[model samples]
Target: MLDIKVLGPGCANCIKLESLVKEVVSEKNLQANIEKITDREKFLDYGIMVTPGLIVNGKVLAMVKIPTKSTLEHWLEKESSI
Candidate 1:
């Protein structure tokens, strides 16, 4: 299964990112482990210097800006195969 982590501090962008990830997972019908990391300290562990970080399978996929649906699907599809 693909492991996805969204790191943020309960901000609007964070919430939207989390929701978008969930939607993509559901739409793609893939089994994934989705986690929301709200603790600021966790960001440091993930080497994230910005809110709304997207980590897929322990690799940082994005930070700050939200990824497009196609971009997200591509990441998810690639990671889920591994």
Candidate 2:
């Protein structure tokens, strides 16, 4: 299973990113543990200096912006396969 983290404060972008991640995971029928990290201090541990960051399997996938759905799907698919 993939371990996914959505890092950000409780902002619009952060919520959107989290929702999108959940959607993709469901659509793909992927087994993953998706977490939303809202603590500012925790963000630093991921080296995230911006809101709306995405981490998959402990690797940073996006920072500061929400990725396209297709891109998100692709990344999740690739990671889950490993």
Candidate 3:
């Protein structure tokens, strides 16, 4: 399963990112464990300095901005291959 993490401080953009991840997962029929990490300390532990970050498995994929559907799907697909 894809271990997906969305790191943020629970802002509107962060919430929207979470929704986008879910939508992409359903659209792609991906089996994933989606996690929302809102704690700043935990977010820092991952070495991410930006909000609304996307971490696929253990690697960070995006930061600050919400990702497009194609990008989300592509990242998840790549991670699923591993």
Candidate 4:
């Protein structure tokens, strides 16, 4: 399974990014667990300096902006194949 975490302060962009990840995962039929981490300390623990960050399987995939659905889908598909 893919482990995905969204790190942010529950802002608009943060929520949007989380939503986008969900949409992509569903559209691509990815078996993933999406988590939202809003705690400041936890975000720092993940080494996230920017809000709206994406951590996939303990690795940081993106930060600060919502990624395109196609990009996210591609990523999920790749992870699933591995």
Candidate 5:
């Protein structure tokens, strides 16, 4: 299963990214472990100084911006196979 994490402090962009990720996962029926990370210390642990970070399979994918659907799908597809 794909292990994904959305790192944020409950900002608007963070919420939007989280929602978008959830939507894509549901629509694709992909097996994934998605988590919402709101702790600032944890973000530092992940080397994320920006809110709305997307982490996939233990690797940070995006920081500070909401990813597009296609970008998300591509990542999901890649990670699901692992």
Candidate 6:
């Protein structure tokens, strides 16, 4: 299964990103372990200096801005296959 983490501080953008991640995962029918990290220290641990960050399989794929649904889907699909 894919290990996905959405790092943020509970801002609007952060919440949006988390929702989008869930949407994509469900749409793709992926077996993923999705986690939400809200602690600032933990965000830094992932090297995320932005409001929203996306990590897939231990790799940071996005930060600051949310990716388009298609892009997000592509990323998740690529990672799931590996």
Find the candidate with the highest lDDT and give its number: 2
Model 6 scores a TM of 0.97
Q: Which one wins by lDDT: 1 or 5? A: 1
Which parts of model 1 are misplaced by more than 4 Å? none
Q: Which candidate comes out best when scored by TM-score?
A: 2
Q: Across residues 1-82, which tens digit of lDDT does each residue of candidate 3 receive?
A: 9999999988999999999999999988999999999899898888889898888989988988887888888888888988
Candidate 1 has what TM-score? 0.97
Clashes of 2: 0
Runs of candidate 6 exceeding 4 Å displacement: none
Per residue, candidate 1 scores C-alpha lDDT tens digits across 1-82 of 9899999999999999999999999999999999999999879999999988999999999999999989999999999988
Deviating ranges (above 4 Å) for candidate 4? none
TM-score of 5: 0.96
| Model 6 residue 1 distance off true place after TM-score fit, in angstroms | 0.7
Candidate lDDT scores, in order, read: 0.94, 0.95, 0.90, 0.87, 0.92, 0.94
Going through the candidates in order, what is the number of backbone clashes in each? 0, 0, 0, 0, 0, 0
- Per-residue lDDT for 20-49 in model 5, tens only? 999999999998888999999999999899
Looking at model 5, the pairs that clash are none
> Considering TM-score, where higher is better, how would the candidates rank from best to worst?
2, 6, 1, 5, 3, 4
User: All predictions: root-mean-square deviation over Cα?
Assistant: 0.6, 0.5, 0.9, 1.0, 0.7, 0.6
For candidate 4, the TM-score is 0.92
Which one wins by lDDT: 1 or 4?
1
State the lDDT of candidate 4 residue by residue for 1-82, as single tens digits: 9999999999999999999898888877788999999998888888899888999988888888678888888777887777
Residue pairs in clash, model 3: none
CA error at residue 36 for candidate 2, angstroms: 0.7
| lDDT comparing candidate 6 with the true structure | 0.94
